[model samples]
Target: MNAFEIIGGKKLKGEIQPQGAKNEALQIISAVLLTDQKITISNIPDIKDVNKLIELLGDMGVTIERLNKDTYTFEAKNINLDFFQSDVFKTKGGGLRGSIMIVGPLLGRFGKAAIPKPGGDKIGRRRLDTHFIGFEKLGAKFIYDSKKEFFNVDATNLQGAYILLDEASVTGTANIVMAAVLAKGTTTIYNAACEPYLQQLCKMLNRMGAKISGVGSNLLTIEGVQKLGGTEHRMLPDMIEIGSFIGLAAMTESEITIKNVCYPELGVIPDVFKKLGIKFELKGDDIYIPSQKHYVIESFIDGSMLTISDAPWPGFTPDLLSIILVVATQARGNVLIHQKMFESRLFFVDKLIDMGAQIILCDPHRASVNGIDKKYKLRGISMTSPDIRAGVSLLIAALSAEGKSTIFNIEQIERGYQDIDTRLRALGAQIKRIEASAPTH
Candidate 1:
């Protein structure tokens, strides 16, 4: 295992660019399987999860060519369907949560697909019911092999139908949309996830000759075409990372400039940070955050404590709630962080409490933070990262602490962020990666 050894209390300054969107890359890369021609994708983030998915595709006989450090061309003209039954497939496919997406494209183009139970962050009960249910609604036979812990779906003929999703699950919607785009008839999806990731997918599909409307709304209409062609796509900058940079600037009292952030696509992220009293200027396509000695949280209009919660698109993102909670530790007022999407995401607050942050974990879903207004700096401690978001949150807290801190299980953090330590070091952060010995049995 590798751990991050950091010396805190150093102000970082410089320009950092957010990587390509991880969530969107998962969907867009999987979409390449829908067409036999070469599809070029640019701005792909060099992260573990995304790379795992790409490697899975390559293992399935997709001809992948790396045009540059961040660009690739994938041609799925001769995919090996037999590989799905191999043990190597089970091990590789089961390791990444994004592997679930390939099933939709495979089932759509090849009439069948199988995947081992996917693994990802141990945040909460991330159910696959949404994906399977959507596939079943589109005339596919769904099966779960309990013995092998695998999911299988096959369709001789897919006929589109109206699908009202139980929830606006982002990955579920993307999977269903991929299958629906190749179905025999029109498919209407209501209550679909309308995040920019989905919008980019739909637009890319349209460019590939698939007919899809309602690009940026909860309702999507797809007119199935005979087949899709190849198209090029450039992923948007990761909004989660952008939000993380904002919170990091406030917590560390650092002056940083985040370059090439798609400002308009980051809906409500800037405003949400502003509500936490973090100030920044949007210049051209960059976000500039100045060093701040103190920032005060804003209260509600009716004098109630400000309650920030995650919702579907156009609302605050759940991924950044951890960042918000961490940033609130040094603010001037109190705020309630309601993590509605995931029950266990707020559990990492205990580590913050250990660091001298005044946080009350109301429950598994909510936390109330009383900002210390920089009266005292957080003292560093050794801790283990729980998930990607919480891992980054702990790193942020460590960056602003009064002494050295060690974060174990940094693999969880590397799964999302691309070269995080190197990027932070560019801004003068005293952080380094060290390999840790495995524990004995």
Candidate 2:
């Protein structure tokens, strides 16, 4: 096991280019299976999850040639050549949420796909009913064998149909879209997650000759194509990582610039931060965050405490709530952090509270943060990470706190971000990557 040890209370200043979205790149890489042609994807983040998915793809006989640190060219010509229950089922699909999507493409093209229950942050009971529901509507049968911990799927010549997803689940919509791209007739999908990730999927499908209308909206009309060909594509910059960078700059009161921000794709993030009293300058596609020693928290028009919450696409991302919570801690006024999507996301506040933050965990999904307002500074303390986002949030808090702090469970952080310690170090953050010699029993 490895941990990130931090010597707190240092200002972070330097330019950073946000990595390509892990979410988008994952699906784009997987969609390569739909063709025997070469699909070269650039700007892919070299993170643990991506590596795991690549490993899984390799076991399935996908030949991936790494062009550089950020480029991967994949050719799935021998698709299903190495099919085995062991190679596919043991993967932590539930964790990626996107992994469940493999069922749709595999079933539509290969007539079968065995996937284990996906695993992710135990934030809440994220239902796969929407996924199974959409696939079932498209004429795929799902066999839930809990004893085996995988979904046994089999479908023959799926037919396009009207699918009104129960909850507009992101991965659910993606699964249906993947399955429908090759189905007979037209597929009308409403309430789809048409965010950048889904948009990239649709775009790739379109390049492969899949006719898809409504590219960036909730309603996606996919004209099924007989077969999708290979096309070169690049993943979009991670909006969540950009949000993290924004929060980091605000906390450290450093003027830092974020390169290639994908200005239009970030729906409401810039405006949301402005509402929180953060100042920035957008130079073309790049964002410049200015320094602020004493930032005031924006209040509602009624002078009441402000509340920031997360929702589905076009709404704020739940992955960024931790960063927002940390930024709120440094503001001058009060704000309620509502994490509507995940039940256990707010649990990480305990670490911040111990470091002298004034926060009340109203419930599983809400926390009331009374800003320190620079009136009282935080003292550093050692803590263990609970989840991916929470772990980084703690690092941000530790960076601003006085003295020293150590973050355990580096695995969770590695699962999402790549070489985070090294990346932050480049920005002048004093952090050390340490390994724990003793194994957990």
Candidate 3:
């Protein structure tokens, strides 16, 4: 219920580093359950969703030791399977979308796993069918307890088989890969998600003695091993946060350097931002965005409107479409944002439109933005954050606005970004966290 109070029109400067990848942290952390030995993971982000997943693991009897602020050692030697049936498990497990990943590792190691219908951003219908269907294809029995809203999977013996996924779902592919790693035979997964995070998972599993090939492609091959041993993994920098900072710098006309961005692993993120006419230079592993008074959007060679859409790996990420949309508000041209993965992700455009951005919400999946070229500054207005990406998008918009703005429900932003207010403050942003007042009865 906390909010962010920001005095806009201040330019941010200095260097900010992106935290460890949130999506990768969820999968890598869940992979600890696949083995009984100690697994060390470094560069873990200090965020709500990742912390919740770690706490859930600790509650399930994993011996977790914090080596430092961003490093942890986890041992799953004597897990208490009985805890899965406890009420505490239902409540905690159901609250996090990442909790669904535990099922594959648990089912692979313990032969059974159950989870309540997971919760996350209400962007659209995020179906669990991709996950359960993958498990079922691998010779696991799937059960849905409709009355209790629980999903249960049990496999006495898992034998690997060919799986052609309905969609290249990242979490689903990770879950199925985790399960397939310990199966009895070779498992081939076609149309798998080939994002860098997923590739990182595959490489880490290979390091842990799981035979996996096709590390950076949509097709993955895994040879099931009898057991996996301990291994160490370091997560990549969060690309979503990196993209956010790039957009933030452009919108606020600030010169900001994003350090240690893992530039090579960012896929098409930089190119996509470049299409929007945002300029930056890659100095080794860092990205430096110089202050810009105006940026223009690029159109097609045939003079058609520039359309940026989300696709699978090596394409534009859906997570940053919100940032792109927000950045497009001040650019010097028009662009169409197509949020193909999630229907409601573009709904936040209303708040930006209220702030004086010329945006037309074509539908739930697409938005057309007519950049005012900074001719009219956006006036600050109170707004509520709808999701993590949208929250940060709004915060960026507020940073470039003409007056003070209040953004309620900042918890959504905190779930993904680590110490965001502190980081922005370090860059000379006029923003502060305001705690909610206690209710009077």
The lDDT values for all models are: 0.94, 0.82, 0.94
**Tens digits of per-residue lDDT for model 3 on 258-299?**
999988899899999999999999998999999999999999
Residue-wise lDDT of candidate 2 within 160-216, one digit each (tens)?
899887686777777788888888899999888877789888988899888989988
The parts of candidate 3 lying over 4 Å away from their true place are 436-441
Candidate 2 lands at a TM-score of 0.96
Q: Cα-based RMSD of the predictions, in order? A: 1.2, 1.9, 1.7
Model 3 — TM-score against the truth?
A: 0.98
- The per-residue C-alpha lDDT of model 2 at residue 14 equals 79
Q: With candidate 3 superimposed using the best TM-score fit, by how many Å does residue 107's alpha carbon deviate from the native?
A: 1.0
Error (Å) of candidate 1 at residue 172 is 0.5
Native-vs-model 2 lDDT?
0.82
TM-score of 1: 0.99
Query: What does the lDDT read for residue 396 in candidate 3?
Result: 97
lDDT score at residue 198, model 1, on the 0-100 scale = 94
